[model samples]
Target chain A: SAVISQKPSRDICQRGTSLTIQCQVDSQVTMMFWYRQQPGQSLTLIATANQGSEATYESGFVIDKFPISRPNLTFSTLTVSNMSPEDSSIYLCSVSQRADPTGELFFGEGSRLTVL
Target chain B: QQQVKQSPQSLIVQKGGISIINCAYENTAFDYFPWYQQFPGKGPALLIAIRPDVSEKKEGRFTISFNKSAKQFSLHIMDSQPGDSATYFCAAAPSGGYNKLIFGAGTRLAVHP
Candidate 1:
């Protein structure tokens, strides 16, 4: 099990501004993920943060908009660029063990962003 | 593609009663299923999980009843307390995949005293 601590638990930003959310894990994990939970909606995978490589994003998500940085096995950052009203949501970072066959994810507290 | 679906957008149960939340998935490749619990303004934590090999698994006050044939699973909280109120989400992922998860629409459960 890993404990993830995310910074800037919440923020209210103006449009066109960019914000970077950080995630730090207690233990080294093989995979780290950034997910967005829109208001009253299910969680959507924004990207898979791979160490030393470009993050693989979902179809609707792009690196230009949601850039990711995975410097090591225990840390990663996600940047929300050119924020808009639609980007207001709770962003969560998740980590998982490599040896476990089950896709059990340990999540961070979350970063609540309000774009005005 | 969103592979998982959840029902009963909201539920209200009295204290000392059983609270059940159900979820269904359309992907047959998903072999591992897990449920997460989240309070307001907090991140979700892993609550309980089940593999399709068994019909049901219980831990403490939480029980996971899984049906492989129907591709459905449920979380049953026994003797639910008011503190147990939160949003419950069910997730599924393939065993050999990249560990990416597909989550379902959450169920908001409220336990009234």
Candidate 2:
């Protein structure tokens, strides 16, 4: 099992501003992912943060909006740029261990961002 | 075909009773199915999971029943308690990948004590 820690558990941001959420894992992981959960909604995959390369984003999400940086195997950051009210949601960091084949993912507490 | 359809947007169950949530998937390539539980102001946690090779998997009070031919699965919680009340999500992913899961909308459960 991998333990993930995320920074800025909760933040209130003004429109057009950007906030970066940091995720730090206890050990090197095979995969790191960013997800978003709006109020009363399910989790949505934002992107996959890859080490030493550009992140792979899901459809309907763009780098210009949700840029990701994975400096190494144990750390990554996600920046929500030019925030809007629609972007107010809980952003989560999840990781898959290198030894797991069933694709089980463990998640952090999540950063709750409220854009006003 | 990436969609996983979940039913019963909300549910209210009495303590000591049973709570069930159902989900159906469109993609046959999906072989891994897992259920996650989320409490208020917290991220979702893995509850239980089942593969197509197994008809059912049980862990403590939670059980996952999978029907490969029907392309459907359901989560059952026996002797539900107020502490068990939370939003549950069902997810599916193909094998041999990074586990880019396709999640269901989620079901909010309220257990009355």
Candidate 3:
């Protein structure tokens, strides 16, 4: 399984400001997933970042609000643009291990963002 | 509408008791079901997972009971202890579609010592 290190583990931003979160995997992977967990809420899929391609965003999310960058297979970044209090949540980055071959994925420690 | 639905927003159990959380999915294409456990301020970690081919899977203190016919799956924690107190989430992913998971609202479990 790949070990993921996420930066800006926690952040506090003012309304209308933006913050960028980065995730680095120990090993190369094809698909890197980004998730958001609001306080006392379920984890929501933000997008799937494929290296060398535009990210596929889930319904209710868009590239303009949550811009993602997948420079390579092992790393990706998710930026929250024009932040608001509703955007405060715990952001997670995850990748599946090819060894399992079962589609089971592993996740990073998560970056908790709080928009004031 | 939520693709996956979960029951009992919260649960409480005593030591050596059994803790169960149930989830139902509306998508029949989902082939993978996984359960995740999250501690305070930590990311959710995979607990156990099951495929449609199997009805049950167990790993140590955790177990996944899957019902393909009903499109429902559950996680059972045996010998529930205070250490097991945390939030558990049930998620499902289809064969394709980038394997993006659809997660349940999550169930907060509190095990008394």
Screening candidate 1 with a backbone cut-off below 3 angstroms (N, C-alpha, C), the clashing residue pairs are none
* Candidate 1 lDDT score at position A96: 86
Which run of 10 residues does model 3 chain B get worst, by summed lDDT? B93-102
User: Among all windows of ten consecutive residues in candidate 1 chain A, which has the lowest summed lDDT?
Assistant: A97-106
**For candidate 2, lDDT tens digit of each residue in A1-116?**
78889999999999999999999999989899999998888889999998999999999999999999999989999999999999999999999886554557889999999999
What are the per-model DockQ values? 0.62, 0.62, 0.56
| Candidate 3 local lDDT, residue B93 | 81
On residues A1-116, what C-alpha lDDT tens digit does candidate 3 reach at each position?
A: 67899999998999999999999998887668899988899989898887888998989999999999998879999999999999999999988755333456788989999999
Which sequence of candidate numbers ranks them by TM-score, best first? 2, 1, 3
- Compare candidates 1 and 2 on TM-score and give the better one: 2
Q: Which number leads on lDDT?
A: 2
Q: Which of candidates 2 and 3 is the stronger one according to DockQ? A: 2
Candidate 3 lands at a TM-score of 0.93
lDDT tens digits, residue span A1-116, model 1: 78899987999999999999999998889889999999888899999898999999998999999999999989999999999999999999988877653446778888999999
- lDDT for B60 in candidate 3 is 96
Interface RMSD, one decimal, each candidate: 2.3, 2.1, 3.0
Query: Whose TM-score is greatest here?
Result: 2
> Candidate 1: deviation at residue B64, Å?
1.2
User: lDDT per residue, candidate 3, B5-27, as tens digits?
Assistant: 99889999999999999999988
